[model samples]
Target: MPEENRTANFGRGVFVHDVVIVGAGPVGLFLACELGLAGCSVLVLEREPEPRSPWKADPLGMRGLSATSVEAFYRRGMLHPLLKASGVNDYPGADEPTSPRGVGHFAGMSLDPAKVDVAALPFRLPSPAMEGVMSNLEAVETVLSERASMLGVEVMRGLTVSAITQDDEIVVARAGEHEYAARWLVGCDGGRSTVRGLAGFDFVGTEPQFTGYVVLATIADPEKLRPGFNLSPAGMYLRTPAKEYIGMLEFDGGAFDRSQRPTRDHLQAVLRRVSGTDVTLNDVHLASSFTDRAMQTTTYRQGRVLLAGDAAHIHSPLGAQGLNLGIGDAMNLGWKLAATAHGYAPNGLLDTYTHERHPIGAWVLDWTRAQAAVMRPDPHAQAIQRVVRDLFGTRDGTTYAFEKISGSSIRYDLGSEQPLVGRNAPDLRLEDGTRLGDLMRDGRGVALDFSIDRRLHGSAMGWESRMRYAAGPARNDLGLGAVLVRPDGIVAWAGDRDPDREAFERAASHWFGSPAI
Candidate 1:
């Protein structure tokens, strides 16, 4: 760990990349794919020699994709491949979008489907993209890695970033005896991010309220344990549908040690105490611990270095928002960073990545904290939980929960009064029988004109290759004549029947920069 050891090759044979990403997890690989798709040279450095782990394979490795995440993948043409690999040909309730089955949960409270109002989510389509998809972490990472490799991204395994130093020109990262240089560096290395620590990013947030566990073990008497989520006087225990997967949350103020691998004896003791049953574990396959210790960096960017995923913010995986939020970060940052690297970005474009995503990160942290507070094994929490349970049974309450958990409620402040302006643009079907998302596979801004207004189509002409222009009739225009969508699928501008040339130009310039001439 000495400076001499970390500084083996300061300048010799330093491979230059447009963007050097640290970590090869789902977030890093997804970001690499996005950047590479935009024609940016990307190199991903992974500390692990191989990308295989029991905790990241199946059962315990399953992650739920929110509506926004599904749409993001669909827009990029990655959803079909991921779904095929995950063996989920279609999402649950895909045939019937209005099934009363729970789509997600808040803490331990299920988001009741009966309470959700489909009319409320106007932007949501009947396609499978609106529903959550369960995918194994290993499968997702594999899909991303394959897509990234096809896009010409270089990934080096077993390379740990020990030190990172950046200046005005480039950022240099040292991984053992080699040095890698890039115009921008991003840390997607999870909660204990080396890039975040070495780059001196200031992370601040609340401490842990409980210690949680994701265990895969054999039970001698499975009949003693209840199916699905169970809350006892000791703590909470959740059994996945497969029955071999179990999760326990202890209100131990995060006293559990994570550095050492958990033992079968320890797992049995905790499981027995929480489930209040004498369930004997025959064997332990995989065990990992987490805490409700929520934290996030004050700023996601520091000079030429940036942070995303668990590297920028972390909280308990109560509502399954961690993976969704990280994917959102990658989708948002990839295009802007690539544009900045390619010298086509408008002023403050790169900075918008942090500004737009920081608030969302803070909300998710507070969300986990609130869920932890309500799930505590105390008199006050129990009373609160009873009331929350009743609320979940109500229509408004369930709709609210779905909005936040599904990422459908998120809307950035794009300085527009229109509701759809800063939200995810609805997937529209054009007159040519093509879906709007299908056109966005190339990763570029889209100027959608539904009214066949020549003026609106002409508005995006100057932007040339940076923005694609399309005008046609749609199955549903939502009463909007036209709209401009960013690469990440967020609506940047919208208008009614009448056209505003100057106003349209202003919105275009704000997002895609001034006219080429």
Candidate 2:
């Protein structure tokens, strides 16, 4: 651990940290890494004593990373480690823009990646992190945990936050006989978040419409079920490449007793009904159930306490948005929170975390809701599914769905009319072969000045510690002379071919606080 991250004894006995995070899951750990990278003292608390779990391993724990999420890892210099941990030797099409190999599925309907018009995506750039990867929770957590440790972020397991108390100066989390204090408290815990409830955050959303289940069982008649996603009249069932893993969705209106462990008989019955085949489950190794019950905290913050990941919003794992959405929340909030912690943030900077992320969370919840509505096992739903299927058949329609699922369509309303101003800055490369991702590894905002005269150089030096300045002719300028990217890879501002130095300085001051004396 670094000297800066060490706990400081404020008084008689109380030790205070800069930020204390709950739930040492991927989101929590990732946020900790970001804060630590910015030299903030961070401590992460987890209820589980151990990190490993069967549910977080391969097959059952499989997850999809959106292109945007992959880029986040790339920016932080964790892309190669993440891909290696996920068992992928190399990602295809690193040097040039290309359509993705998979666009994932919608309401159990698989999308054809070939139909995705890569040319239609906004400011699409070719880079190593251009495409998404198939990974499991274990791999993601492992990579993040290692990086967090490297950044001097502390993780203490087997601590469950029982209570939370806060004031203007600091927040305290009580777990059993121990109390941990920090200037800020962030809840990255999952759906049944104790911090959210303790902090008085009002959660609101719709109820569940059906019960979904994932099971690992020995199938006596494996041939009875088709491979991959299967949408039936009764419901849907997915048979993965791993023969033992099975996923089924039944329109039980969320009435199935998920409290009790699902038995072999029940699993077989649900499988038969959903698959419309008498598939036999000889032995059930493991099973878990979920629902399309979409819910979200009305606000992400209450005083000194903030929430991220599933702690802020939750919905069905339809379209595999849970992990990616939580990752987006962490990436978006990390640097902003760090800036505020360092006491160099502009007015209302922390507030922007909620303003920016809440809408994205709501959109994800509604996205799952739409999928649930179209997969309700009714004539109306079937009709709608047919319509959606037809839409998926079109090139433009596939591209649209691809945009949403891959998170390429997301453009934060940064109050800028410039097309790329609020979007994730493409991996703009310089003639010297330096990419934007390489420059962001230190967790500082970057000013890419591509003007011939290097006009923004002197202005960028005012806030040297808060931003990195790189100047050169870009390989592809995307019609812009320069772009100011926030530490989280968001394009804060952009300049035309002439390049305005005043506008660039204003953007720098606006995001990085007043220029240093």
lDDT of 2 by residue, 323-416 (tens): 9999999988888888888788899999998989899999999999999999988899999999999999999999999999989888898898
Alpha-carbon error at 382 in model 2, in Å?
0.7
Report the Cα lDDT for residue 461, model 1. 74
User: Given candidate 1, what's the lDDT at residue 370?
Assistant: 93
The list of candidate 2 runs beyond 4 A from truth reads 1-12
Could you tell me every candidate's TM-score relative to the true structure? 0.95, 0.98
The ten-residue window of minimal lDDT in model 1 covers 1-10
Residues 239-327 of candidate 1: C-alpha lDDT, one tens digit per residue: 87777888998888989888988899998999999899889999987888999999999999999999999999999999999999999
RMSD of each: 4.2, 1.8
lDDT scores in order: 0.85, 0.91
